[model samples]
Target: MPLFTPEKAQTTDQAKQNCVFMNTKDYDDMVAKCQIKPLYVQLNGVVFLAKPLAECPKDKIMLNANQRKHARISLLSNIQVEPYAPQHSDYTDLVQFAIVPRKALPFDSMNSDLLQKEAISQLIHRTVYDQPLTLEFEQQFFDVTAKSQTLQIVTNTTFFKFSVPHPASKNLQLTGDHVESAVVKDSQLMRFVKQTQESMKQKSDGQEQPTDDDNFELDIEFLGVGGCNKQFADIFRRAFVPRLLPPQIVKQYQMQMVRGLVLYGPPGTGKTLIARKIGEILNAKEPKLVSGPEILNAYVGKSEENIRNLFADAEKEYEEKGDDSELHLIIMDELDAICKQRGSRNDSTGTGDSIVNQLLAKMDGVKQINNVLVIGMTNRLDLMDEALLRPGRFEIQVEIHLPDKVGREQIFRIHTKRFVAKNAFDPEISIEELAELTPNYSGAEIQGVVNAALSYAQTRMMNAQAALEGQQVSLKEFRLLKKDFIRALKEVKAGFGKCDDKQIQLIQQMGFLNSAGTTPIIQDIQNYIQTIRNSSIKLGTVLLHSNSSGTGKSSIAAEIAKTCGIEFVKFISAEALVLKAATEMERCNAIVKAFQDAYKVPEALIILDGIEDIIMYTSEGMRFSNQILTTMLPLLKRGQGRLIVIGTTSKFYGMQALDVTKCFYKQIHVDGLDKTLIDEIVQEWCESRNIKWEGGKASELQCIIDREIVTIRALLQSLEQAASGCNEVQCSDFGKFFENTW
Candidate 1:
């Protein structure tokens, strides 16, 4: 008889306890009619344990809210009071299985293990299906679901999976075969459970286990690496770690394992360190650390043979273990040394091409091995062969960029942790300040800074001992000071923070431009620089031109480059061009090389001082080297890397005639100082240097600015000449000095 009802069950506490009550007579009839005593009621295709309720109506069955929700029914439902029997004859005393909560629970508030054990205890001596089981935790009962299959619990059950929601459900998409072995201790399920429990215990005990989001149970230790948490996360997600699931699970899901990844970035940014650390952290066999140059040989076929030998063990392991093999790691540094774009190699020997072919065959050839993970590190990712960068080869590429301020702080703390723990580091040294000071510093460079600081402290210790003359001195007294770190900054140069000190000195020497006459022009140039910084375009060019010579155009250019905060400030002056190269082609080549070098770094500023002189511009025949002019135009417009070019020239009309003015993003004409501006500059300069300057002969100084195109350069040179001979620079001395100089 149909006995289930669609009506909501009564609110009695007893009905809420995962129990469905049935009428006494109907239950007795069903039990008697069945060949075996009825133990479960099958309602709406779901089975539940049957319990008799004397008060229930004879025509109806009672179900709790949980039962109705699991059943997914609304109206009147029919039920069969059926008996359960084991289908498999070799039923063991114990079964291993995994369970997932049908809904989210506060695992943090409850004893997770106790809840799992309680759920296991309830299924003892009962027939279990691959369906929901009501389990109690902290006096609250909930349904725990498993894979959509059946399992018969004969005597006892052990949970092989628990919370944080298994990765297989999301990452690998587990099938029935993943949980099919409902055997005793020797089953794959039991092995997996044991490994998970061990891993969880290690994590709970405050050990640094491999990142758990991807759920590959391995021990990873990046002892000295810092500022690369995101990169490591990507490696785990897109590389070999995600494929660390059991052989059966992987086979059932038909997922391909990640075999190769490329880690490329600026030198000293920890690409090689990350690769080496990954090799150390994985549970794979010892990694083969071969540099790109190591594969090259003079003999024919030898380089290819060397490449094959690197994969020899992995191939053999795959042959023996098939899909059940342990992982093999191969880390290759300087990968661009051999993998330059195919057919671009200039060598006649063709050794580089053979090495690349051998690597491709080993990584993704016919009958490829599934157990090897190749990690290639290079700073020049653009030089790698395109074929090796596609999917199923070195498919995953992660750029290990230089650490930011926060990452720099982390690297500093990591490097100085032992010193801090030993109380040898200064208590007042603000690490945040150091991080701010060391902009664009790589992890290795940060380590170098720490080492340099230590060297300073050691030097102080030796000096103290030398002064004591064989007297005992406490080692703790030789702690690193704030000044030591400050001094160390000068000693260690970061790869990205490579600035020229001569440019800074020149800017300092050109301090006269801070007067009222030049402030607006300086501010305008600063605005242009800010626009370049905010825009998506990588290249920006500005031209500072004047109608007359000695207008301090080069000084203004140097000041702009120095104060803008770009670490790489290069001055490509005509003197440098002439001194470095004699011929016009050689000079053009030098100019091209300067821009190319700037592209290697993330940001740079190139000051083309005296642009007319560099191009050999002359009034005679309107002649300038067309070769240099052509090279300079494209380089100024080249949109690669974060580059800002400031070109200075006195011959504005000549540049315009040659069409070179169009290459600049902005053009500002610099004007010479007028009479009133010259008076203000002279007064400030005298007060700054403590020289007496009363404008008793101010009218004579006016003649200095009275010329048709008198530049700031001419006025400053006159003042310098007057100051060279006397204790005070008076306005009267300017006329006599100009008479002698001109």
Candidate 2:
């Protein structure tokens, strides 16, 4: 039995008087009687004739045709014409027929009318072998009728009640080779047959609906641990501690989850990398990495819509999977770009604040979106809205700072180990020394230095490869060429040089020291030098303040000697004062002995270079023990004739604490040149090398100053490289200098 019900007559009176039969031929008359025009004529509940049933004049038909004969044949065959009605009893094997009129129909019944007509047409063509079938109908004019017995007929122009066989009893089992199995099975095909239906009743009463999976999970891994300090890592680890528990325990405990974390730092300090690493460490199942720019939209209100969509989509994904354990990590890089402070009326209105507001609302609306963690990275945390950083939002603020000496050395080792394995150089060249020398170098700078060294080595190897048929870089070649590698390390010019001459002169003039004879002199000198050096004067003592560098101290002292118009003499320990050659007094006498020789010279400047090696600071931070001070006091206080004893100490503070300040009339600090001086030196160097400074070359000189305000020696070397093998000092040539210096 079919589920479809068709209009049917209940009584004999209604069946005989109201029911009307229609064929393709009588469709027009039937439609006319009902004050409608037939659009399609049906047979066996399927449309057999769908052409317009109106009559057309021969002339009108011929006007549109290539030949009048063709037009006349189509007009007569395709159009429906009147036919005799069939009796209800004669329609015992009646096929259902649907009649569609050429007028607007109600929205609800229009689809059914079209589908019935189509199904009837298919049945006639396939099962009925294109044979026409008689259709009988009983029409009722009453407004009301019984719900089950009522037969409602809807046409394009009017509503009428029709009596026909019950739709279930009239079900035609479609047959024939022309029937498509796919069409019979297709729901859409069934809809075309006026059998469209949807199940409204619940499958099982009182059965609970299955809940959607609302949980998200994520697995994050930190590769190449980002440049986060141990403290920061600890904080991050603590924040995600709960996530490390077993699933069952985690569910039972209801851990206080960390929702958001922010990484703040200067540009190029690896905030983004740290954020990424933290995300990896958290090990969320679905971590969404989004750049701040992704949230912006071109149209007004569209950015807010996008933000909403992003969260909505994430929730939808969790829901669809029906998994509560899924973790969602939203990593926002350059967050300051999209979460700026709200603008005042005077400021341009559109900005990150609007987007920030949307994010804030979403974040606050949910108490425990357990699996979702928001990590934001910003170089300019100050520019972000305060609301974004408040207690519940990005509460965990981690700072990513420039690497310190130990960190830099670790970074350098990581970067250069490959190069070291390939090239032959002293592996013992002191990374500690390198770290000390690279004062303010960031991790990126350390990498650059290593890369520059490798490049230099490659260039040398390339030249050598051309000369020698196929020779690996030999130890000798690496030693000779590895000067470039050392040069690369020197490029970052850590401004850890000695104090300058002006500072030394100022300390002397300040009368911080009192001259006395023997023991009194050494003690007074030590006190004066220490006081002046450690004072809060804008400039400290002018003594060379470099670390343990023998060559640097010697060169600087010799230069000062020459500048001061004094005979510079190196005082070897053997020629100076001595007690027992092995005793502590002997070491003190050795220093005093050197000073005595310089004091004997009327105006000689003695260079006590590498003083820390000769004299050690006592535990009191004073340079030289009391016993050594006793031996040196006499020579220092003697003040031989007009001699200006210029003792250069690399460790000036250590020397001061030794109470050796009274010996030298003036102390001169020799530090690295300022940018202005460096620039002047570079200009002079370019001129001396005959390198033309064309194309606003002064600016290029200034850039070098800006990049690395190095020592006079470093600046000179850089300038030489900038001018090397070129008549004109082009800006491009500066790269070699920077490569060598950085």
TM-scores of the candidates are 0.67, 0.37
Cα error of candidate 1 at position 671, Å: 1.3
RMSD of each: 17.4, 29.0
- Find the candidate with the highest lDDT and give its number: 1
lDDT of 2 by residue, 625-722 (tens): 56755665555555443433345565666666556664555554544455544434445555655667654355555555565334444544555676
Displacement of the residue 15 alpha carbon in candidate 2, Å: 70
- What C-alpha lDDT does candidate 2 achieve relative to the native structure? 0.46
Model 1 lDDT tens row, 220-339: 222466778677767865764345454456566776777889998878888988887776555457789999889888889988999999999888866764544556888999999989
Give the Cα-based TM-score of candidate 2 against the true structure: 0.37
